[model samples]
Structures are given as structure tokens and as C-alpha cells.
Target: MSMTVARRPHRLLTMAPAVLALGALFVIPAAPAVQKGDDFLTPETTGVLNLEPGECFTDPEYSPAAGEDIVLYTTCDQHADNQSYGFVHADDGPYDRVALADFGWTSCKRGFVNYWPGAAGAELDYYPILPTAETWADGDRDIMCVVYDPRGELGGSMLPRAS
Candidate 1:
């Protein structure tokens, strides 16, 4: 199960269509009342920023121009489109698309390795959800690292189990 990695820029106009088609775009909305480590028995629409590590969700519908995206949180035991592996924070600086991408790439790759230490050969792929300039100005600096199986839905949590 080797890992495949890809980077998905957040809300860039040029890449918006590709991001939406890949279900990588997450909408901004009133934060959902979900706590970290909670299991979502049923799907619920929420902003991407609301997602926490280990949470599983369906691909969200995003309107780039509207500055919105929606992800449906679901149980990891169920088949889902993507999972939140971890998050990275951009350094304190003016938003530079290229700089952000580079930071996200390096951070996400490192996070992925730490998250799945022995799963280097896992059949998984990952990408980062970076903040757009608008979102950055609005004080959104999170880069979410998402893991998914390119072939289809993830049937269960990829986190290694405790012995």
C-alpha cells in the first residue's frame, strides 16, 4: 500500500474548477458544533475548517466565487470520500500563493509521514487544502491535509490501530 501524494491549492481561480471536480474544495460556513474525536453517525454539512484530525467526510461542493464550501461529516467506519489527517499553519506573513503552496507541501508531507509512520507503502493519496487570499485576509491560515483513495471511497479509518 504505497502512498501517493498531490497538492491542491485552496480557492485559486485558475485551479478552482479542478479542485471542485476532485471534491477537494471545502466551503466556508457557520462553524458546526462538532468536537474533536466525535464520531458522526450520520452525515452533516459543515465548513472544512470545522473538520478535525481523524474525521471522515464526503467531498464538499464549493462555489469559489461565493467563498463557500461544504463537507459532510461521517463515521470513519463508513465509506467516505476523504479524511482529515492533520493541519498545518502558514507562517505569519502576507499571503503569497507560491510561498503558501511550498509551505503546505512540505508541512503536509511531513504530517502524513508522522500520521502514518509505518504506512509508507499504504494505498493512499493525500493533498492539502490551503487558504485563498480572501480567506487569508479574513484570518484563515490553516492548511488541512486530507487523505483519500484515488480509486474510490475510503472504507474505514486509515489510522494504525493500537496493539
Candidate 2:
């Protein structure tokens, strides 16, 4: 007498999809989401340096078209009289959805990072940052200006501080 055992290889394959979906579901909860919207600045709104309480503009540092990149000079100060702290500068991109922290002349931990604005219909995306480091400590600044490169392409949309 002889006996045979049948193995279901397709069962393993079918399980693969489920495992991947399950993993993605868990990852979705911890990620930041970005949204797309209109610009808060009008062409008539001049004097970005003398902006009002809820005003902002994009100061172009670098710009690339088609096959070029643009870096921008940005300054954000919640306090409108002196542009002392809470300032960020990104000299490396016309990139989409990249945020860089300006650490000044030192090799501070800075780099492009992604952020998601919440409240409804959230999304998952990424951006750029400069000098990325984990052990960075705040050196005395209440407001920090991050060079925002929104994949949503809403870079000049007057984003507020992350609360």
C-alpha cells in the first residue's frame, strides 16, 4: 500500500496579501497626513517683510523649471517686529513636500521631513529636510520656521506652527 500527501502552495500565496494589508493598516495610524489648498497671498499683497498677523509669502531662494531645482529664503516669526528667532532657510530645493530645519552655521540635526495636517480627509506623504539628526536639542526658540516642501504642492500656503 502507498499513501500520498497533497500540499496547498496557493494557500501561502493567498495569505501574503492579507499579511501585507494588515501591516499597512497599522502603519497608516502613525503617519502624518498633508492636504492641498489655495494660497493665502494675493499678487496685490506686497511687502512680505511687513506682513500682518495672518499673512505670509514665499521668498524664492532657488527655482528650477522642468529640469531645474529651486531653493528659497524663508523667515517666519509669530512676533512681527523683529525677525530674530523662528527663522528657517532652505538652500537646496525646488522639491515637492520636503521640510528642512535651519540650524545655522553648525551641523545641526536637520533634514527634509513630511507632515500631515489633520481634521479630515488626511493623506500620507513625504518631503525633504537638511541636516537630519535625532539628538537635536532646542537652543532657545519658541517658533521654528521649517522650509516646507509640500507634495501637495501647497508650499506657499501660509502654514501655521505644528500644534
Candidate 3:
């Protein structure tokens, strides 16, 4: 799939071409060896489709020349730029960028409300990391809904706390 990652502008509702590339200053190494009985081991770089709900990560950085995207997983308690809230699968159909984006936007919006019911009045915003034509052709149909605090880094997960 060429390792390209597409992202919409943070907090924007308009539909635009999904050709923007996220850039990072440094590259992280591959996944570390896991210890016995460990619950989870986050990889240094991963596609958006691999992120699970409530997992925190830095925004992915991509270089068009390199045709690669790098997403660094981080602990929710630490400072991070985004968090996976939910995922939506695109319906079976021909590859239409607009159609896919429309479906993703609508679905992810509903997911955002469901994931964080109290976010309507907050400064938090959500964006979707969608599949490109290359990725779609390779059977990638998942859209990841990610939430972030527009003001700065998120100190914790956006998932609602238990009562």
C-alpha cells in the first residue's frame, strides 16, 4: 500500500482532497520484544487501521518522497496528540475517494458522539484517518476516528471515566 497515510485538517468539517502528508522529525525503531504475560506491546509505527479504541499516539508523519507514514504509540497518561476512539468500515463498492470520505465522516461523527457523549461543549475535536486509493485497492476499508484537544497535547484519554 506504499505506506502513505492521509489525514484531514484538525477540527475542520469541510471536504477536501486527502493528499496531505504528515511529517515527523525522527524515526522510531520497530516493535520491541515483549515480556512474558504482557497484555499489549505497542509498535513504533503502525497503520491507522491497526489502532484500537482508547489507544493514544502521536499524529502520524508521512513523507511523500519516502512514501511512508510513522505513527508512534504512547501511553494515555503521557502527552500525546491523538487517541483512537472508534473505527468504521466502508461499504463494499468501487473506489471513489469522495464516497469513502463521506461515509467515513458521517460514521466517525456518530462514533465521536457515542465515544464521548459530553464532548459537544468541550474544546476537543475529532478527525478521521482514511484509506487512500492505494490502500483501498489492497483491501483496506477501515476508517479510524481520532480525537484530540485542539488547544494542546492530551494528558489523558478522552474515554469517559467510570462513575
Candidate 4:
């Protein structure tokens, strides 16, 4: 006499969504604390002079206005609400606020798309942290490209997701 054997079906595709949901929950605890303000120059922000490209941080009160002190810096993989894509230098001599603003706008706009190719129409937004007229004369000409989520607070790096 001979016996027949039966095989079990795999549930890989059916389990995908559940696995993804569980994986996402891990980063939820790392979310940065959101701070709102009337303007970006709120006293709540601690001044940080040097923030390198790919660095991540949280701005309790983020302001697009130039000249404000840098905000608190945090780990990109940990408690980061925002990240810096890159820095662009301004034109030499006769530092002008208007010209700097225009340059920052153009540079940041280009850099944003480069860093986040799939960002078009997404909830993400970016702005440039440019030197104020006073700071510019003091030799501060770096324009920092910053990315953040306006819809809500974020807890992890925004880089890998774009890809």
C-alpha cells in the first residue's frame, strides 16, 4: 500500500503588510518633540554654529527668515525631526540680504530635488538657513539646506524614504 502527502501553502504576500506595520512601529518612539513659535527666531532654540551635511536635528520653532541662531542638533537615526541635505556658499564681498535670499532659494530648491527625487507633491518641505546681513558681514556665508515634515512631527531620517 502507498500513502499520499499534502503540502501547505505559503502566506508570504499576505503577511507583508502586517510585517511592514510592525516594523514602522519601531521608529514611532523616536519621534522628535515639536515646538511651535510665532517666528523662527524664538529663544527656545539653542544656537549651533556648525551643522554638517546629512546631519539631523530638531527646531522647536523653525523659521525660514535668515539670521536666526541655529537650532538644537539631534541624531539622524534617533530623534530627528529634520535633516540638512547640504550647504551652499554665497557670493563674495558686498554681502546683501536680498541677494542671499534669492541665492538660498535657488540653491535649496535644486538641492532639495537632488536629495529627494521622489519628493514632488509629497508632504515634505524644505527651506534654507541663510546668514543674516549682519552675520554675512561677520563672514557667515553658508546656506544650509533643511528638510522637514509640515504635516506632523518626524522621528527618523527623511533620506532613505525618498529613494
| Winning candidate number (TM-score) | 3
Over 4 Å off, model 3: 1-49, 61-69
Best by lDDT: 1
Structure candidate 3, residue pairs in collision: 22-61, 22-62
Better of 3 and 4 by lDDT: 4
Write the residue-wise lDDT of candidate 4 on 1-163 in tens digits.
9988785666888789999999998765644433331234322245545567878877654456744445667887666767778888877889776777788878888987877787855767777777766677677778777787765655677776542
Query: For model 3, how does the per-residue alpha-carbon lDDT over 1-163 read when each residue is reduced to its tens digit?
Result: 5887897667443423232322232455655432211112112235444568889887657757657766667888787878888878888678887777678768878977877777754767777777777777787777777777766678787888778
- The 10 consecutive residues of candidate 1 with the worst lDDT sum are 34-43
TM match of model 1 to true structure: 0.62
**TM, every model:** 0.62, 0.19, 0.63, 0.61
Regions more than 4 Å wrong, model 4: 1-45, 61-70, 161-163
The Cα error of candidate 2 at residue 1, in Å, is: 11
What TM-score quantifies how close candidate 3 is to the native fold? 0.63
The lowest-lDDT stretch of 10 consecutive residues in candidate 2 is 105-114
Instruction: Give per-residue CA lDDT, model 1, range 1-163, as digits (tens).
Output: 9998887655598887787877744655654332221122111234566788989988766657656666768888776878888888877789897888788778887977876665544566677777777778888888887777665677899766777
Deviation (Å) of 14 in candidate 1: 56
Local accuracy by lDDT, each model: 0.70, 0.31, 0.67, 0.69
A best-first ranking of the candidates according to their TM-score comes to 3, 1, 4, 2
